[model samples]
Target: MRNILVVNGSVSGDASVSRALVEVAVQRLLGINPDASVTHRDLSHGAVPHLTPATVAGVRAVANTDHELSTQALSDELIAELQAADVVVIGAPMHNFSIPSSLRAWFDHVLRRRVTFSYSEAGPKGLLTSKRRHMRSFDPPW
Candidate 1:
């Protein structure tokens, strides 16, 4: 892939095994494609805010207030990043059998209705036609 997006969702930061795994995967990918570029999004540092009514309004393109407008801008930016990337690597350490809240928040921001997907007569249709590779590091809680 020419453009790679590495999203780290582990709150454990440097101590996260999932993050380490992602690093290895990224390095391997880079080794194969020496000219490829990589962009990182660390969600543990409050980079992605949890969804609120304002954020919902923004993602829906009904933003009116300043807060909603700002949230919408963020959502747009995140979606743009996703659209530009050819590969997406996600580090997700199991948090009570689910992904971290920050990662969930990121999903909430990027998975915009009619932007990433749409309803069809048969079923849901995906609008992002570009081929994407997703590598997620899932650590099960024992």
Candidate 2:
């Protein structure tokens, strides 16, 4: 079974354009793939940890469990979800004519150098290869 990670990059809990867009897409995605599963990670619901020195160190220790970092249990869960995705769909809004910060944070969490990408003579390369990439936006013309 395929797992699709749907990241809702809206800052507001209610009346967010990104949330609406993601909802519609999630429904359509469900219709298209009956067997596939969808996981929703809301950028702004209650709270999510900010990527700090402690958090970064925690991520680095995932490979070797002996050397641990942050004691928060959610860090391990978050890292696993990111690495296990079969595809990633981000619902982003142009804040100040640019993508929202949470989406950027999501990238920071997932786009680790050795974990999610590789540096080669040909330059940087993506470690994960998925079938679909859907980035939708709803912002006033700017």
lDDT for every model?
0.83, 0.65
Q: Model 1 scores what on Cα lDDT?
A: 0.83
Which TM-score value belongs to model 1? 0.89
Question: Any residue pairs clashing in model 2, and if so which?
Answer: none
C-alpha TM-scores of all predictions: 0.89, 0.73
Model 1 scores worst on lDDT over the 10 consecutive residues at 133-142
Clashes of 1: 0
Residue 92, candidate 2: alpha-carbon lDDT? 75
Cα RMSD (angstroms) for every candidate in the order listed: 3.3, 4.4
lDDT of 2 by residue, 1-142 (tens): 3787788778777887667766676666667777878888887753455566546655554533322354234455665676677766777778888887777766665666676678999999887665445455434322
Model 1 stretches with alpha carbons more than 4 Å out? 133-142
Residue range with the least summed lDDT across 10 consecutive positions in model 2: 63-72
